[model samples]
Target: GAGVSQSPRYKVAKRGQDVALRCDPISGHVSLFWYQQALGQGPEFLTYFQNEAQLDKSGLPSDRFFAERPEGSVSTLKIQRTQQEDSAVYLCASSLSFSPGMDEQFFGPGTRLTVL
Candidate 1:
């Protein structure tokens, strides 16, 4: 019955650094999502997974952004060649189902990344 969780609450990276962020969704949840929140902006959807299958990745900014959920519960988001523009908060959310109208998503505290 644990809630969604993310690791490395904060990260400081130099330009061109590669970083990996982790997320652990609530147990038995069927849907997981990743979002990016830039300063003073609302969170933007990055990708989504239904179980182990990545159903949508249209929101990923570039090839440098990658996400995976191999076993359906834990996920990782990786960014390569970090830039100052990439500094933002990464959030993870999970829902009991993938239905947009039925399930409510629980969000993690988010990981703040600062690229210098």
Candidate 2:
């Protein structure tokens, strides 16, 4: 099975533009996570999904940010009306456990979004 992978590793977006980042996690992993990492900081949790159900989205910065894992495999993070503050590395992670935080997560390379 493939490890976690993110597409368009780098994205340059104009302010107010909407961007969609993709993530492909390891096969059979039941838990998925989305995070935002700013310069010199650690990844901050954005959302979590178990199977096809979104279990938590408490860490999303605002309503402009949304994530989904519709089929329990591939996931997407969509940012609408992107602001300069939205510039960051968007990372996707997955784990074998049904409970996300309970297990060690394997992270993807991340799609870095640069808001101009």
Deviation in angstroms for 101 in model 1? 1.5
lDDT of 1: 0.97
lDDT of 2 by residue, 1-116 (tens): 67999988999999999999999999888999999999999999999999989999999999999898999889999999999999999999999877525878999999999999
- CA lDDT scores, all candidates in order: 0.97, 0.93
Per-residue alpha-carbon lDDT of model 1 for 1-116, expressed as tens digits? 67899998999999999999999999999999999999999999999999999999999999999999999999999999999999999999999998758699899999999999
Model 1 lDDT, residue 44, Cα? 99
Q: Give stretches of model 1 more than 4 Å off.
A: none
Best by lDDT: 1
Which consecutive 10 residues in model 1 have the weakest lDDT in total? 96-105
lDDT of 1 at 115: 99
lDDT of 2 at 98: 77
Shift in Å, residue 11, candidate 1: 0.6
